[model samples]
Target: MFIRGGNMRILFVFIASILMALGGLPQQTESAKILATLSMPGRSQYIFVENYLKALAARGHQVTVINPFKNNKATPNMRFIEATKVQEYAQEMLTEMDGSNMWQEFNGYTRLMEKINSCTLDDEAVQQLLKSGETFDVVLAEMIEAPPLYGLAQHFNATLVGFSSYGTDFRIDRIMGNISPVSYNPMIIAPRTDRMSFSERLTNHYEYLLEQVHRELVHLPAMERQYKKYFPRAQKTMDEVLDSFALVLLGQHFSVSYPRPYMPNMIEVGGLHIAHKPQPLPEDIKEFIEGAQHGVIYFSMGSNVKSKDLPQETRDTLLRTFGKLKQRVLWKFEDDQLPGKPANVLIKKWYPQPDILAHSNVKIFITHGGLLSTIESLYFGKPVLGLPVLYDQHNVERARRIGFGLGLDLHQLKQEELEAAIHKLLSEPSYAKASSQISERYRDQPQPSLERAIWWTEYIIRHQGAPHLRAASRDLNYIQLHSLDTLFVLVGVPLLIVGLLLKLSCRLLRGSKPKSCPFADKQKKQ
Candidate 1:
């Protein structure tokens, strides 16, 4: 109780050291639980889920992937939640519609939308998974279609992160108050000078409005009624849940996308699924690439398009053009045989695209202009000869106009024109230079896209939800966001006054003022 001054100071120093040590101790890393939902079993989806889960798991986190697939043989660290059969949906729809033109395509899409809209999160299998008592910090749902995933997020009181596989327009519109549902076809959605006219724009808007009305009034209400029939206790409406949710993680790059205003939470994490390490090329493919004296031309129609589906006329034209090119060609075709032998062209069913693009000998890429392919071409600093088949290809081409002048439409494609474009891309240095400039911009990203995505996801979890990142667009009316109301107030009000004064002057002598009341005279005297 009775201590000397020197001893008291020493005791204080000892206490302070202990407190400092305690304060500087490393914070305990919490085990984060995430539920990742991929609607279908596809290479792209698989890669994205796998990489994201791996990244999370590597950082001492737990990931559970829920998909239509039952095969859980891939990664050991993560858990899998198998849903009831849904692959049959796609198979049946594809069979029913077949590959048809735009009108038929719309009909097919409508049918599929109806089918997906029927699914509920409270199904027996879904409930069984929930019974395990596993709680998640966040629900990462793929933007396949509007589903009960948002409801699940609400039920768990967890953050909802939308993993968008498409471009910004439709998804951005969905996040905002715009209820118009536009069909996403790169070929059509991507604005083209030759294809999209003023009338077409009006038609697109009308179509979107009709689709939204159908979904909200007819489709979603019916689904909710059906879900209530299955689960009597489910109280939330699908529309309320979807509209209330914020944060859209888009799988798109600004370099490949057209200029548009976006919400703060609308992040462009394009190429997140791209493999970091290059896969080895087969011996024959290696030899073929090596054999080219000038350079190699790589041609692929992306993941969806099968080369066998190409029309005979188109195939023949492509082959003939390849025959004339001085550089060797690598064609990714499913078929083994060709009509005529082109000495320089090598045909293969598959090619390691990223690896080939990274190759020094690869001078040009002839692509169908899928977003991923276009971005990769830009990432590798190579000029693209786009033969856009469908979906956002037109948009990609339009965006590319600012930099590389290498995009060509499939409709305008001919042997002569194809040859001319290819020759120009190869011979002209500007295309390559422009492409490289884009690649530099892409390479100079603040961080790797996947890391940025992971950081944001974790940050959301830590903060209970990063509401600050959500864009003001969600709360703003169209007029307010675009300043249309302000413009009208400033310009229209002045113009209206001038017009009224002119009309009044016309009715009286030119220099005469309009009759004033006693109130005006009183105010002037005051």
Candidate 2:
């Protein structure tokens, strides 16, 4: 139906008004092209990052994931590039790991970081991707140890987002410009808690200073060399690349992790990896779990640390202890054969951990206290017995502090101690109560972690890196950030003023005639 000229003008104005009103409301964002790199070796690490990437894809974003462990089946809106050399290196390093020696663990991990950076950079597929002229709206990479990977954001001319599988550490705090006060914020490797004694605080400060020096002098220099070699035409240096990160999705929830300060750009997506609906347990494992008249105690040493690597004596102690427990034991043992395996205990090379924990009959988790495993336990509302062998002590220690679990040194574990702790976790109602309370608090978020992560990622994309969220401290140096220069001015100025006043008074007193000195005159009269 054709309208009259006057009526057409009226209709156009009415349509324009409706369009203006619609524009005032929130609009749907454009689907983003996201390049996510998870270079870390552990399958556990892969799980967290993979879940996040899948969530982005589910939101209709195009995501390309580069990692050592690639999924066999590709989902819609997602592509996977396998870094095979990295996979081999990780397997070799993790297989030969000796978790009892802290120095060895540190050194091995340091070497692994070097390998991850070099291998990922040198991978044929990654090299192909580099030269393909592909563009990404955002480049998300695990920020734990691979500083060189930060260059990818610059390479793709994309917004930088850091994904921390290890949660917040001195390195993460440094990169994100979060103020980590040594007095209260203990380093991840530090054995001390947030509440520290004078000596502990000193130790914490020393640890921070030492790691800072090592990162600057040793680790980052090597990464810088790699960055220069790989992306020679890149504008920013490695250090600048580190500072350019728009957001960090941290694997920590304040409900479980240490209560510390975080910048606006630093987000906590603690249990993002946990499936909303966990998979069903295999039939045999299901029967074993269900048949336990008493509850089941699930044991695992996480992905990196193999249970079969335990010392024979330690394995024997574990076996003997499990034999005493009335509850059924499901252990993630790499080896198929346990010579003296208990009738009540079932051993497998792997188990669907989150699924196992989700079962109502699973009461206590005996874990290596890795962050992901602990977070899973918390998600499932189960108490844990942490056998922490290395850096994982921090995770277990926090659990102990929060009364969700107890930790024991894996190298120094005793059968009696193991048995007793297991009994304590099973018998004590408070531990279960704490686990339940913390789990409720953890689950009580404005939205689920995955949704929050996707929203933030897209937020950065919509705002073109969201530079406003970045901390201003990123632009400051050591003295400026700590305000040492200002502090010196504040303290030294007052001190110098007092010193000058004292000097001036002394000069006046010395130069004045004896008669003009009232105090001197009084003293003489007396």
Candidate 3:
């Protein structure tokens, strides 16, 4: 059925014309080879990142994950390079991270940053990444640990995506540039409520400013050292590389998290780890939960904090309080066994967390207020009691405010305080009601978070770096961004005019009086 030579020429021209007309449409490409790096050693955080990459791989992308966890069952499209030492160090540090005081917390922050930089610098996987000669279409590096990791994008000659599983990153916020005011956006460490008082808002604002100062003075300088060591051949400065990130996959949704203005380059995929259907719990735990005539209480401090590390008095206080409860307690106790066990409480080293939360018998949740836990508890519509010890004070505080829960300081665990909070949440119906409302709002997303993430990731590849998505604020300087200089002119111009008019008036008055000056003196003398 071959066409004649004249006819073939006409057919080619017709097809070429159609392609030219549709040139304005998106240019979709083949699956990308994505290098996704998630090196912060928290397992929950790892799960969130891994889940997204899994979705991408399922969609036919060639995904290589640089991680701290050991290899799990692998897939044809997925590969893992684990940093074992970095993994072990992070676990050890987080176990003791709930510091006793301000100095310890500040010191802990610095030491952890130092360890991350040093450990990652010596990480064998990182060395391999630099020398492997393997290329990627995109480099998605975790931004929570260190800024130097962003330089990996320059090394790969790929689009940089700053991934912060911590939900919010002030650094990335500044990088992508949005119209975020300091007044409402509290720092991760500030324990402000959803409804801030005038003084509280001021405190949050000042604390945010102080944190920015610390990042500039203490944090960035240390990260810059690693950046220099990593990508020495780059023509641009490290600051330039940091500023040029093509996308930021933030683990925050404006609906669940505080509403803030975001740029196109910043994509929020808040609940990527939440499975559509929760996996089933173990046989014994399932039976126990089913047998509970009274409701159940589930407690976990997440993977980082171990129950044994708690002070003896604190452990005693918790045990004594739980012993009297009528409801069944499912505790994620790390120990093989609790020495003084309570009849009402069941001890398991671990349980299928989401599954337990989904159970009808469960009435309340007690957690360390890891962001993942906070979000999941709400998703399941259970009132929470937050004992926030490490990392984000704001997460637990926010949970306490919105999730109909009470927050307690990890360092100051009193027996009465623990008992009262537990009793109140269990007996009161308002907490559960509040939790259900938030859950309804959260589940009302137009699409699941994972779909949005995958779409944006592929969007970056389709457009070959989507530079148009960048916020206009990224190009602005401090004076221009805040319009401080413009404000000065607005206030100063009127004052300047008044000053000039006043001077002219005084000069004219003096000139009018000058003619009588000599005669006035003579008359006075006579």
Q: Per-residue lDDT of 405-518 in model 2, one digit per residue for the tens? A: 998888888888888898889999999999999999888888888888888888888898888887888888989988999999999999999977765675598665655555
**Ten consecutive residues with minimal summed lDDT in candidate 1?**
179-188
Per-residue CA lDDT of model 3 for 65-152, tens digit only, reads 8777788697879998787677667666764455786445655676686677667657877797788888888988887746666677
Question: What are the TM-scores, per candidate, against the unseen true structure?
Answer: 0.73, 0.88, 0.87
| Backbone-clash count (model 3) | 0
Ranking by TM-score: 2, 3, 1
Instruction: Give lDDT: candidate 3, residue 258.
Output: 77
Q: Model 1: residues >4 Å from true position, as ranges?
A: 1-29, 40-42, 45-50, 68-73, 81-107, 116-133, 155-157, 170-188, 192-232, 244-246, 275-283, 335-348, 403-413, 468-526
Q: Tell me model 1's lDDT, rounded to 2 decimals.
A: 0.68
lDDT of the candidates, in the order given: 0.68, 0.85, 0.79
Candidates ranked by lDDT: 2, 3, 1
Per-prediction tally of clashes:
5, 0, 0
